[model samples]
Target: MLAVIQSSIREYPLKPQHLLPLALATVLIGCAPSPDEELNATLPQLSLKELLPQAVANEYCNPKLDSDLLYGIGYQLYNDDKPEQARSCLIMAAPTHDRALCYLASIAEQDSSKDSAERDRQAFGYMAYSAVKNDSCAEFGMFQNFTYGMRGQTPDIDLGLRWLERSARHGDADAQQTLVRLHSNKGNLPLAYSWAKVLDDQAQIDALKQRMNPQQLSEGEQGFEQLSKIVTSKDAVRKEAREENIAVYSANIHMEYPETFKGLSVAERHALMEQAVATVSARPEFSTRGQFYAYVIIAQQAQLKQTGVDVLQNPQIVELLSDTELEVSEAVKKADVILGQAAL
Candidate 1:
């Protein structure tokens, strides 16, 4: 599931001196508006669902459709700011679709009506349901609820800490980031370094390095090696791809080529290019957007060589390659290294 909470709702003052302050000073000047308030301001005057026909809604809730397809449709609808329609599709997918459940919980949490207590209860129930299925975001939500106390529940720090660790291990970025600070504040630099390394936060790694002596740094490195085996950035990459609509684009790729793309129409060729773009963008190995496009160019060239169909001839492909923002040569070299590793 996409990480629902960007900024934490409640800041746990575990070790105040060791806590990292907000980088932007202006954000601290006054009472900042809640995340819900910020979200409400940006929402469209009319929902996308309001414009669509009733048949579309019925189709989304169709029992004949695959759960994955239903969830994907719901995911797109939710991101497109049509929560009411999204909720219907999500409900159809239900308990089997854990990420859909998370999205539902997020939608419920945004309710500001007088019966919001009931909404909170429903939201908490959704998170609890998904958490047991090992959904990282749900696990993180459970950690937040248990640690801070919500929906008339009492705070239990010990239980919350356990959930936090579980969430981090499951590759929830927020939980890992929280652990980095918590461990650092508690003077466990090795554990802190392990998580920071997992996140590939160069600044945090560098800062942590400066604070450690040779022995501590060595131990941190050893800890990182061990931690990395269990936690990967792929989960983070997948979440990012979903939020950016890259997953939807990738899903459009037709892997089974009955005929060469060269024989296809202009629209089909454009779609082929989009598929190639999506493939590269969804990969975790590419470090930057420039690198992603560069790799796509390389991959497309390979495809042309193998199938004798020049997808790169498509206008969309040509336009993307023409952009000066891409660092082609260097990124291609790095991508080659990743390719070589996979080949081994």
Candidate 2:
């Protein structure tokens, strides 16, 4: 009945004499059959799928579908254990989608069965490159590669530091947290405290306190105070410090000083020890971006412990070790010895 009416409405002849009655009838009939009546109609009778395009065309202009919607659908498909279909959707969707590009990069770099570690590394490099082209968020993965030497990367500390700084300045909390760790490890307590202050959550602060000792936190606060004073002062030295020392002071310890603790001065060694302690404490507190915390801290501390004892006959470091604390693996011990001798 509605289709017939609609068809008559479309085909209704109009002449000068009938114009007024036609207009009146059209107004009384309204645009389509009643919506409620349509709801009571059977699926087989309505054939909604066939009519949907025409219905939409009648109601509005071309649809304003967003790239994000497609990406979301693609992500849903991916999470539904449909990788190939998800990949196809994402491929079609990514041309205008930055998040899709980032996801593609992650997927390419993450699919272990698709490639060897070396191949993945190369693939990640390309993805990182693509990500950077899109926006600042892409730097996150690039920094990851620098932190861990992959595919003969040889650990480019400078690149890692630069990328982290770039990402942090762009309001990335993960990058900010990383900078805090990096600065804290480098004994740049001022920077670490500054980063920590940005978190602005009481629970988070308490959790951080649980990870780091009061003494360390106090020292960091003092460092921040001192730095604040320096920046506030009009002194030439302050300018010089900002211009020159900030880079050295804020640099990541692990990347900048990758060497095992062999030739470090007593002061440097003590500072590093404090950093190691803080690092160990902070590791378990963060689970989201802190995935590698325990591994990195353990490896670094073990290396430092082994080399410090092997090189300077420093009973302090040796005394710091317990029988069960040191790794007794022959290869590790041999590497420690080599690092110790290299320092001398």
TM-score of model 2 (CA atoms) = 0.39
Per residue, candidate 1 scores C-alpha lDDT tens digits across 213-305 of 988888788767766655646766575445434433322222112123335554655565557566555645445555554645556544644
With a 3 Å backbone cut-off (N, CA, C), the pairs that clash in candidate 2 are none
lDDT of 2 by residue, 1-344 (tens): 00011111121121222222232243346745432123123112322132112212111111232343345455655556655555555555555554454555555555666556654654454445444542335555555555455433556655555555545443455666665655555544445665566533355446556656667788656543533332222354334333222222212232223353346553654465545444434635323212222223334545555543322233433332322334434334544554465457
- What would the TM-scores of all predictions be? 0.59, 0.39
Tell me the deviation in Å of residue 324 in model 1: 11
Output the number of the TM-score-best candidate: 1
Residue 184's lDDT within candidate 2 is: 52
The per-model lDDT (C-alpha) reads 0.60, 0.43
Q: Which one wins on lDDT?
A: 1
RMSD of 2: 27.8
TM-score, candidate 1, is 0.59
Q: Model 1: which ten-residue window has the lowest total lDDT? A: 17-26
